[model samples]
Target: MSTIDTSKPHSARMYDYFLGGKDNYPVDVAAAEQVTSLFPAVSQMARTNRAFMHRASRLLAERGVRQFLDIGTGIPTEPNLHQIVQATAPDARVVYADNDPIVLRHAEALLHSAPEGKTAYVQADVREPGRILAVARETLDFTQPIALSLVALLHLVGDEDEPVRIVRELVESLAPGSYLTLSHATGDFDPETWERVVEVYRKGGTAAQVRSREEFSGFFTGLELVDPGVVLAARWHPDLGARQGGEEIPLYVGVGHKS
Candidate 1:
């Protein structure tokens, strides 16, 4: 396991702080505070994003997606991807990947699988799509449909990291009928406030880039989008009982099928 760096703020840890999780350090708290000071609704946005992940995971599982590969999995919050999907389909298999060593330290919480299901965690960065897919194959069958979830993750990946290419590589590795579920923070609603938030993250030593709606939609260039495509995070499948009145949340979310 890599050593956990406490000097500089990490996106995963900072996110944990936003979600009211206690797994973060002082550095993360400071950075999260800076973000909140810039955008008061940031914490609400984080919670809403998490709710979207739960809804998407359960919907895919209900639609017969038995395997899930969730990259950029943050600190283990209760009712994680495996928990949500496996609840609907106990035989569901889930593989989680994240680069944060602190997340790795708390990975035990993520490994509690349902008796009929299985779960595994990989300490890998999203940039290393090959490694993630390779390890995920050990648990998830690449020949069957799998839901590739990148929830509230890509914004931390700057343009230089080639996030779209990363998504393409991961999606290409899955079989036909595979699904891609993504939720990313966007600056389309309030670009100026988001710009300041990005600078806060950069000064804290983390690469942050909020995208426009068009740029966010580019990730699903070839895949077929599901109903109510590319809307605010809360608008995607709200029948799943996601939080209400999230119109101000500056995040774009959608799920697509690889037909």
Candidate 2:
């Protein structure tokens, strides 16, 4: 089992706390509550992000893409990426990656793949794109179309981390028709609230770099964006689905084809 340090607040566990799940520690709940005070929509944002992920996965399955590489995968939630894809295409294969030890410890939930499909977890960081790709290749074919999802993950990556470079490496490794699905927190909606939330994360020992629409869109350079390009999470293909708990929050979601 992966060791979980309950002293610090982890993004995944904090996220789980925000969603009213029991897997989070007191520290995570504290941090999540503090952030919630600043931006009450944070929990809604979490649900929205999950909904977008479901829609994206369904679109990929409908498009005949059977392999998925989800980086920065958080604690396994119900109807996870594998569940959504496998519900439509039973033979789908998925590789979940996250640096969080807590996620690795609870990864058993993610391992329950459909009998005809494959679900595996890799204990790795998003910055280590090559390593993730290498291990994921065992389950996913590099020559075929695979959907790469980084939903609500990039904001945690600070400026010094060179997120753009990491994305470049991952994008270059994928074949044409492979898609990149992303949803990130932005300061555009409410700058003051975003700033307060960023401070909360900084105090928690994690970096949060909330980008604008242009900066978020910049991550998709060299790729072809799908229709209704890079819109708000609530607006992104809203007709496709809805959240189970509550209304969707303000987030930007987009899907881009490698070629």
Candidate 3:
């Protein structure tokens, strides 16, 4: 297990704080406060992004996707990926991967699967796709369709990490008919505010790079995008329960089928 570092603010912990979760440290709170001060709608943005994940997972389950692999799984909040999918399809199998030790400590909350389903957790980083897939295979059958969820995650992966290539690698590993569900923070709406937000994260020892719509769309290069593709997180399949509020949250989301 990796040691829990409370010394510096972690993106995951800061996100937890944004979501009103108690799993974060004072450092995380201080950094998140700075971000909130910069963009007061940040907490709403976080909640909107989270809602997209829930709706996407349930929609995929309804479409007969029986397996899921969620990378950068943050602190467990209610209605987690597994819970939402299993509620839609009781036999759904979910594998969660996160590098955060605080998330590892709360992994138990993510394991309460339905009797007909299964769930597993991998304490690995998104940069280590091989390790995540290896552990996920223990619970998910890669031969069939699976939902690869990267909700609110890729933005934390700086350009140095080659995030697009990482997404390509993960998607290529999946079987045809699988889906990639992603939501990312974007600076297209209010660039100046987001720039300051990025600075705050970097100062707290976290690397963050909010992308533009074109850059965000590149992640789904060869996949067939679902309807209303690559729109604001609130606008994607709004009927599925995502709030279609008038305020634009600086987040882009989409679902694509690997056919």
Candidate 4:
């Protein structure tokens, strides 16, 4: 088992805290509370991002895509990607990846797949696309359509990390008809207030790089976007119930096909 450090506040744990889950440490709660004081919609954004994931996974599974690779998968909240897809297609396959040991500790909960479907978890970082792809393929078929999920991830990947290039490498490994469901943190809404929240995270040793709409859309460079392309998180296909409980969230969401 990977060691869990409770002294430093990790983003995954902070996110779990935002969602009212009990898996976070006191440090995480303190950092999350700081962000909440600056931006009360923090929790709303987290919930909305997760709802969008459910909608995106269900949509792809309904479209007959049975493989999924979800990276930066935070602490397992219910109705995880596999659960959503397997609910529609009993034999779907999902590979969940995360760099956080906190999440690795909870990986088994994320692995409870349908009797016919299969689920696997890899403890890895998003920056190393090759390692993730290599390990994930053990449970997923790279020759088939796979939805690469980067939900509420990427912003933590600062400029030095070459976030766009990392995404390109991962997408390049996919076969045609593969999908990319992504949601990123944005400063488009209440920039000043959002800056305060970002500052709080930075103080906690997490570097956050909120993106602009164009920058967010740039991640889908060579793909075809689905309907209502790249809009506010709450605006992305709400018919699947991605509504934000009546609050405006700054995250931008989109799903693209590698055709």
Candidate 5:
């Protein structure tokens, strides 16, 4: 059994709390509530970000990409990465990687793949791209084009880690025709409220950093941007059902394909 340290707030559990799931602890709730109080849109951003993942996965599946590598996968929310992709391409193969032990505890739900498809989970961090790629090969074939998903993740990686290098390293490992899709918390549009909201995570013992628009877009360098490039989460393929709201979502999402 995986040990969960409930005394401190974890990013996965805090996200589950925001999504109105029962998998969160009190500490996570308190931390999430603190952030919500600072920026009411925090919860809404969570939902919007989730919706973007679904849309992005489906888009990749539609492109005949059957393999996926989802890093920083949070607690099993309804319509998880596998469920979404399997619905589109029942033969799709997926590998979920996360550093959280609690997420590993609940990974059984993620493993429920279609008989025609497959799923695997790796207890690894995104910073160790090589480790994740090696372990994920148990389910996904690295020779084929894969949709590498970093949804709602990178911000947790502090500047000292040189986040751009981390991302580029991962991108370099994938085969061409592979897709990279991601969503990031940014302070570009509304710096005041967004910065305050980030402080809540820092106060809760989580080191988080929100990126600027230019910085966020840099993650997709050297890749072909999908149509309607680098837009707000709600604007990414809205025909696939985006959140309904007039306010700007704090997260920016984009999908790009390697040539």
Candidate 6:
């Protein structure tokens, strides 16, 4: 296992800590507390994101997508993507990518796959789409439809990084009929709360780019958005699975088909 640096708070660890998980350090807890102070709904937002991922993954698996590429996969939490996908399609193959070494150390927990399914983890930053795609290709056949999920991830990639171009590159590499499911944080809900939370993350060594609703939708350009396009994460296909209600947490979620 890699040695975890408790000195600096990592996003994944902070997220895990917010969700009341034990996979984080004191620094992470401190960061979470700071963010929560700014936006009291922080924990609820994290749980909502997790619930969205579960429903989206299940919906994709039911739609016959047996392969998944999940980027910015945070600390291993119960009922991770693989569990959701494999439960629906036993043969599902999933590759989880995260920049945090702590997640890589806990990758073993994520590696536990159903006998008929497979799970692998790669330690890579989201900006390196080439490396991510190359490693994902080993488990996911590019020729087949793959559900590329970037839930609660893009906001972490700021403007200087050209998030649109990064997403386009990854989407272009997939075959037709592939899908992109994502949920991103937005400032459209409450600018005051958003800015404060952004400052907290920025101080933690990562810049948070809380995008506008239109900016979030822009990521789906050149693709057909699934029905009820770009609604709140909780509102996307609620009937697909579990629904955890929280009125204050704001997130935009949508799924698109690569035509």
Supply the TM-score for candidate 5: 0.96
Better of 1 and 5 by lDDT: 1
81-160: candidate 1 lDDT, tens digit per residue: 99999889999999999999988998999999998999999999999999998899899999999999998889989999
How many residue pairs collide in each prediction? 0, 0, 0, 0, 0, 0
Off by over 4 Å in 6: 1-3
All candidates' lDDT scores? Answer: 0.91, 0.89, 0.91, 0.89, 0.88, 0.89
Candidate 6 minimal-lDDT segment of 10 residues: 240-249
Candidate 3 wrong stretches, greater than 4 Å: 242-245
Displacement of residue 84 (Cα, Å) in model 4 is 0.6
Q: Name the runs in model 4 displaced over 4 angstroms.
A: none
Error in Å for residue 245 of model 6: 2.4
Candidate 5 lDDT for residue 37: 89
TM-score per model over all chains: 0.98, 0.96, 0.98, 0.97, 0.96, 0.97
Please write out the lDDT profile of model 6 over residues 21-107, one tens digit for every residue.
998888889889988888888788899999999998898899899999999999999898999989889899999999998899889
lDDT of 3 by residue, 1-259 (tens): 7899989999999999889989888999999999999999888888898888888898999999999999999999998999999998999999999999989999999999999999999999999998988898899889999899998999999999999989998999999999999999899978999999999988987779999999999999999999999898878888888563444788999999999
Local error of candidate 4 at residue 52 (angstroms): 0.7
Q: Report the error of model 6 at residue 96, Å.
A: 0.6
